[model samples]
Target: MAKVIMVQGTMSNAGKSLIAAGLCRIFKQDGCRTAPFKSQNMALNSFITTEGLEMGRAQVMQAEAAGIAPMVCMNPILLKPTNHTGSQVIVNGEVLGNMSAREYFAYKKQLIPDIKRAFRKLEEYADIIVIEGAGSPAEINLKENDIVNMGLAEMVDAPVLLVGDIDRGGVFAQLLGTLMLLEDSERERVKGLIINKFRGDKSILDPGVKMLYEKGNVPVVGVVPYMELALEDEDSLTERFDQKEEGLIDIAVIHYPRISNFTDFNVFEQMPEVTVRYVTSISELHHPDMIFLPGSKNTMGDLKWMRQNGLEAVIKRMAEDIPVFGICGGYQMSGYEISDPYQVEEGGKIRGMELLPVVTVLQSEKKRCQTKGKIGMLKGCFHELFECEYQGYEIHMGQTSYMLNNSVQNVCENVISENGKNVYGSYVHGLFDHGNIAYRIVKILAEKKGIRIKDGVFEDYQVFKEKQYDKLADTLRRYLDMEEIYGMLREAHLE
Candidate 1:
């Protein structure tokens, strides 16, 4: 059986995911076969494994840190919020349909068997499993049938490291209050406490750490300083959206309400001349050198939102003069029409922006796989993209067909659009991840805008990410009491 260590946070975005990932890297560095587990995860961001299984991106990121291929078993239950009240539930990489908050709460307990099966699968492959918890475990009202935090810890016989975000303020209260709310057995599961995202002197926090240990009855294992990382964020709480007009080349990303896989554009931030900004309204959608439409979870719903908010009209008008690119659901919206006869997404056919000579129809079976191909013949402003080979992944529920016309052309094996125009659309995510593709796009945009850009190539994204994992592990080793952590794991395995 694999030894297990779990990280539980005082609140959502309390650094649980990153901590879990850091531990996975540490365990891998220590020559242990490691894997990450999250019984339940609620996030818009997700990934498709090699076997065409869907899982939370957090586990996928951790799997990368552990030097393992991402697996669906890492995240057994993924809840993607489609609206304010309901989420599309996925179990073991397959969708179980949408359910309201009230409905899912009642139905979740029935999934314990499935969760256990996934854990067992991970146990077969790993020497140690680093489990991550969703949100806070101290919600006493919702603790009855909980299986993500203390309940999961008990099930796996895992020791817990409770983490609190000091940057959010009230760190002492967050830690002590959480422990006080838990039942005696649940509280005892926490072997250590970590104050994360500290931005001040360690000496100034020494007194509070002592008091936290005394009140929570757990050792203060670490005071982790806030480190800027370029890792993919799990949800909308990501601060990357806050950056606007920072670089020489202005690239605007239409911020849809249910945006999925926004990480597709993370590579652009690596370019010295590129400024990636998320624009939500017409006011924020000023003149930009390039415009990008990102993937959306609810294609029809987000299209309706864009129409209602007057963004649809603005995007169509902007496409005539500026370079407009779309991926996944955004690619669907760029076409002439979208049909959902199978009720895949709220049902009924809707008119698209008419920028591309294509039509999309949502299907029950989702396409989830990695793909690689060279760019085909291109025309007009985007002719620079011609013959460029790229690699990416596809995860969508619709199929698009190009309208038969001499003007329209297939840009790639999986990408279709009208030629002799600036507008382009494709279902491939991570199209810009390649340094060559990203550099070409930036160079073209800089030439168009007459902005002088330095001659330098962007770093390979995969190499950049690997270095980040090493940096994260180095930071954790400096602050976290690894001796005590290993001791807890040793004791758990001995039992």
Candidate 2:
């Protein structure tokens, strides 16, 4: 069995996920077989495994840091929010059903057995397991049925490392207030305290750090510096959405209220000559070289929202001048019509953006699989990418029909398309994961603007990500007390 250590944050987006991933990388570098576990996760950013099973993207990122293949066992229960009050619950990579917040709160305790079974499966092969907790353990009302935080820590006999985000302010209050709220036993379970995302001098924070130690009665373990690393985020709270910068090649992604898999465009953000901005309104949509309609959890509702806010009309006008691209739900919305006979989304028929010669039907059955082939079937803006080999995954519930008589290229085995030879859409995610596809896209955009780029065109996305994981591990080793952490793991082994 693997020795377990749990990381619990003071609140959501307190950098718990990255901290856990850093530990995973550290363990892997030290030659330990490490894995990450999160009993429950609620996020729109998700991935499909080789088994065609769905799991949260954060665990997949952590699995990458550990240098291992991602498994469904790493994340057993995933809750994807379809709206403000309800989510579609998935267990062991399969959909259980949708439930309201109140309904799920009352029913979550019943899933304890499934969580345990998944943890045991990870234990069979892993030498060390780093578990991540959701939201905050101090959410007092939900503590009774809390299978993700202190409850799971107790169940697995794991000591907790409580993390407070210094960047969000009130570092002392955030740490001490949370300790006061926990039950005595739960408070005792917290073995160390970490202050994350510190941007300034250590001398200035020392007095407060001592105060936190005295008040919370836990040893201060680390003060991780704020890192500018390219990593996948779990939810919409990511700061990437707030960036409004524009570069030589401007690419705007439509930021729907329920956007899923926005990670699809993260690669572009890393390029110095390109800017990928998430636009929510007409003001943010200014004259981009390309427009991307991203995946959404509620496609019909988001499309309606765009219609009401007048973004839909503006995008249609812009599509005549700029190239427009979409994926999955976005692809469905770009078509001529959509009907939800199976009620997969909001029931009823609706007119689409009509950018492409295709129609979609929302189906109850979701199609998911990994795919790889040459990019030999596109037109217009993607003409430069002909025969460029690509690898990615497809995941969606809508069945699209190409209106063949309407000048369609039916590009790339129907995984991507060229309509009117100007508009494009694809059902695949991670299209830029492995090659110069991103480079070619930028080159196409730059050519349109009559500009020249001098950077090298080839990019191995996996190799780039591996360098980032190493950077994370190196940062943690310098600031964090890893010898103390190793001691805690040794204690777990002795127990």
lDDT of each: 0.87, 0.87
Across residues 262-367, which tens digit of lDDT does each residue of candidate 1 receive? 9888888867767899999999988888889899989888988999999989988887788898899999999888999999888999999888888888999888
Error of 1 at 107 (Å): 1.2
Per-residue C-alpha lDDT of model 2 across residues 252-283, encoded as one tens digit per residue: 99999999999999888877778899999998
Task: Give candidate 2's error at residue 61 in angstroms.
Answer: 0.5
Angstrom error at residue 132, model 2: 0.1
Q: Worst ten-residue run, lDDT, model 1?
A: 406-415
- The residue-level lDDT of candidate 1 at 195 comes to 95
Q: Candidate 2: lDDT of 214?
A: 79
Which parts of model 2 are misplaced by more than 4 Å? 405-415, 419-421, 455-458, 490-495
Residue 15 lDDT, candidate 1, scale 0-100: 94
lDDT of 2 at 359: 84
